[model samples]
Target: MGILHTLSLLFITTPLLLLLLEENVSNVEARDHHHFGKKQKIKNSPKLSPAYSPAPAPSPRYPPSIPSDPSYGPTPTDYNSTRNCIFDVTDFGAIGDGATDDTAAFRSAWKAACQVENGVVFAPSDLVFMITSTIFSGPCQPGLVLQVDGVLMPPDGPDCWPKSDSNKQWLVFYRLDDMTLTGTGTIEGNGQKWWDLPCKPHRGPNGSTLPGPCDSPALIRFFMSSNLVVSGLRIQNSPQFHMKFDGCQGVLIDKLSISSPKLSPNTDGIHIENTKSVGIYNSVIGNGDDCISIGTGCSDVDIEAVTCGPSHGISIGSLGVQHSHACVSNITVRNAFIRDSDNGLRIKTWQGGTGSVTGISFENIQMENVRNCVIIDQYYCLTKACRNETSAVYLSDVTYRNIKGTYDVRSPPIHFACSDTVACTNITMSEVELLPYEGVLVDDPFCWNAYGLQETLTIPPIDCLQDGMPLSLAENSSYAC
Candidate 1:
């Protein structure tokens, strides 16, 4: 009876144990499958979602709206594309020995590179390339860069220049848009011979004068171009203007060191004419003539962070010469230092001009021993031959703010000799304290037909300023240019 009971118990227990073992195996397989799925996900899937990924950065404006605040520099889009499409001037039969005429080689390289988009015309570094008067004319492909790393030397003197080459300009970039000229290089204009011309101030060894033809060449000229950039260049000893921009729009010039001898004649550092929306930033200009000169048909120009010395200072030209009409407006020069300069801030216009100059601002300027700290001479004649005329370029809405300086005792700190018939209106000033550099005797500020309010009492008080516009300009709409 006992044996029979044992067999029965064993039968029941064996079936239950088999059932439990099957369930355990199935559970283990399911757990293993779940772990494998997680591993696959970890191995195959990307970490970040498309929604979380950041977007690419934006490109900079060629000529930024607030160009006085320049926050960007030139950068190539694709290095490989630029390298592959390089048109090397040396490869175009250029001899970088400083004596060979590299003009033809440069022309060839430019012609070839100008056709390719995102092209680079490279001037090899650590060499001196001599070129005669040459013009690099182009309506180049979208992104063109003239990367000049070598020293570019022009002809030794005026005697070396060919007669066919116009004495007005040497190296010219004409009709180019969306182009950049940049690199760590030097443009040496051997201008001693031109400066010694009879028409110039320095005539002969003994300071004697001689009669001769005198037409000096500008070092670089950008003519009839739009969307241009000139950066990181050192231009020295230009015969005339170092760099001139004529009929250009959306132009930017930055980080330039332009210089010439203190006695160099008519060597204006950077001159702009008929150009709009122009920007000049972070430059050092020390030349004989105006560091930065603005001619007629100029508007929306912004100049900042400039160091000008041994110069005639920055000027708004002898505009409206020969009884021509001149219209200039919206010019701002800010955060500049003028030291040992002939004039600090000046606006000189011709006597018999028709149009007007308005909406000008000079702010945060520091002058040290400047001869004429601030001046506006309507009768701006180089010689005594300029006869006075009734109609003149009307000057209005000119603001000089926070201009502090030391001036030479010879001349008054501020001189505003406006037009007699068309008096200057809204000529405002604030915090202008100009002390005499030599003595305590400070010259009084001079004013003629100038109207404005002083925000604060200046060091040498400006009691000469008269209130109210001239009757001719009050009734005329021409004053509102």
Candidate 2:
């Protein structure tokens, strides 16, 4: 009985031990499956590389922030879509041959390229084409460009063409839109003979003021057009005005080199009349007459970044008598450097006229060796001399700021002569330092009966008024009182 009981106990113990071992094995298998599943998930999942690690993003390089100011929106730069057109002159048969008459070739190219849905008249390289008087009349689609790669040479010899008025002007662009002339090319007038022509040897029958006809051809002439652009060209030696824009709108002239000798008569760098929305910038002009002459009917014009030498600085009006319906307004000239010029800033109105000029501003202009830094002559067109007159028309709302320069003592620094009757009103000058020929700083002189200016104006020191002075008006009875 004892042997049977011992055997039973041993069997029971063995079974219990075996069952515990099985349970332990099952738990180990279950844990291994869970670990394997986790490993599989990690291997199959999308990998996260070092490049995509999240962090704060960097700021934009340009236009750091969206523009919130309405007035500070993106301006019209040269890179605008409206100004992107590449019309090559070479593709248009612009032969650079010095002897050949490439006028027909140019016209053909212009017609062909301009016929496209959106085309430009491109002058590819330097072309010495002899151009007779031709009219480039256009109702050009917007965004048309005229890219000049080379020079447009006028007829070299005076005797080569007919003496009639037909060949008087070499190139004429009339009634066009969105036109541009850009590149290092030149428009040479070849005016040696024309400029040498005697000024009609004698005067008119009445001995009246008959200006001599311009013997030389004009480099470029525009009439009754709009949205014109002339940039990056060396326009020189025109017997007449280098570029004349008459009765045009939205004209822009930038980065141009217009020059003639100091004695080159009637070589006005730019003459704008009867136009609106004109701008001239980044230019160097040296000529006989006014570097920039703003005639009657000019409004809302801006001229900046200009260097004028051996010429009149900035003139407004020579308006009078026969030309009576003259009006100019909202003109601004800034950041200019003038050397050895007759006058830094000038406004001349006819002794007898009926029109109004308003809202003119000249700022940050540096003048050296200027005869009259600032001059306003009511009696313009004076040949030998001028007398004080009461018949001058009205001029108003003119401002000159930050005009620092040296002047000749022989000529007064500031001469403001307004009409005694019509009166010039709202003329303001601030931070203007006129260093006399002797290097002495002097107060600006105000002419009497100039109208609407104060007497005994408080002057500021040179250093103190470096940038500019606030625009203000002082009340006084007499012009200098």
Candidate 3:
């Protein structure tokens, strides 16, 4: 370490070690003082000592924390201080003024941090660091940490974005294992200009199609990783999806406050695809697209106690697009609230795609002023003129228990537009109550080729739901996984 760095470590370590060892050190000192001989030696020791008492200037044995700046960071973890290898970004020439580019400093700090066991890269509180698109690649030692107690933001817009970097994602964590990114801070995307792009659906004249590529960046993503935890983060205003996890497993996301303008196009709060063993709990999200969207190849996902509003609600698949083989199963969304959203609980798939969506449950969900409270659209399409196709993904074993909500009168409360050939089967709804928000019922809750029995009488009754297996049930079993 350099002179400045040595001093920095010493300064930070003093308080942290004192915080950790104060009680033990006090007890030891009291035990020593209890002996009369040690007290007499201590009383005589000052005679042998110099005028300026050198009491071993606060032992730097433990790991260092953030410097004693006005913006001291929070305690990142409760682990033993001996296990932490701390690296502060400010030590590597980071100027956290929110305007200056801190990409190099952050990169350099991460390089050092990733080399050590139980590595911790600390972004201190009361600072805003703006960086460009960068991937923090890792095969680091287990228990790597990114303790962000401050703000992390991107450049102003696309014009300021680097041409060499990818436009699809920003701040990607690739090939990481056993990583925990927790913070009482903000990861603001500053995505106002990206939302105003000419290629955006709402941007062009008369909402017309602008002939251009409309690719904007998702704020943060974890790709090809596992055993990851992200919590206590206030992530907002993404150019596209706020947080996406792809090809990862053992993921847990909690206590996040994710938001964007309702009009911002394609700004899903959290999208997880090709991942499994995930738990998203106690998070609140309001954005343009689905609050949480589950994509293909995902299973064993439990989402609970999440609140969504002014956004499309939790969804499973806009999957199997372009004749792809998609598989999703064992997804549970329970104890959630949705309000002022487009589609509350949706499972949408495109035509001409073959796969299987099964073992899904939506329990104890409440909604207000939402359009299409519970839906399964097998023929999902953006364009008005989508030709009907016979081949489709088979959806089965879906249960909706204790779902009560109010829906916009424009769309039906419960709509199931299943494909004719591969109809949805074994669908059961128990204690579902969907009421019209405008106090006047639309009198049409449609269900097509959906085979399920209602456990209790539903409001505006689902009399359209069929009871037994369809004749095509034997043929629909071809698509499995």
RMSD to the true structure for each prediction, in A, is 30.5, 34.9, 21.5
Per-residue lDDT of model 3, residues 1-481, tens digit only: 5545533332222444323321100000000001011111111111111112112122111111212121122346553264448888999999999999999999888878777777888888899999987777767777778988899999989999988656777787877888888778999998899988887765878876476577788899887888887888899999988998989987877678999999888899999889988877778899988899999999988777788979988889887777899999999887788989988999988889989999999988887889888888887875656777888999999999888867786777888888888889999998887766664565557888899989998865778789899875774444878
Candidates in order, TM-scores: namely: 0.84, 0.71, 0.83
Question: What's the CA error at residue 12 for candidate 3, in Å?
Answer: 32
> Which model is ahead, 1 or 3, in terms of TM-score?
1
lDDT of 2 by residue, 1-481 (tens): 9645533332222434323212100000000000000111112222211111212122212121222121221122332343334445555565577777676767766655454545656665645656565666565555556556577777774677545434445566765776666666787777666555555222235533246543456667787787776777898887667787878887777778988877665677898888888777778899866799888888878777788888877788776533365678888887788888877798877666767788898987877778777877775653434444444456777887777766655556777766657666767776666565443444545463454332223222312111222233233222210
Highest lDDT model number: 3
Tens digits of lDDT, candidate 1, 1-481? 9645533332222434323211100000000000000111112212211111112112323346423324344444343355778888889999899998998888778877777887888887888999887767666676788887889978988789987666677777766788788778888999888887776664865786554456678888887788888888899999888898888988878888999998888899998889998988888999988899999999988887788989989999768777888888999988788889888898888778878889999988887889878888888765665676888898889999888867776677888888778888998888887776665445467788899888887756888887665555556654445
lDDT of 1 at 469: 57
Error of 2 at 317 (Å): 1.2
Best-first order by lDDT:
3, 1, 2
Q: Which stretches of candidate 1 lie over 4 Å from their true place?
A: 1-81, 205-208, 477-481
CA deviation > 4 Å runs, candidate 2: 1-94, 164-168, 200-215, 382-390, 437-446, 452-481
Which model, 2 or 3, shows the larger lDDT? 3
- The positional error of residue 412 in candidate 3, measured at the CA in angstroms, is 1.1
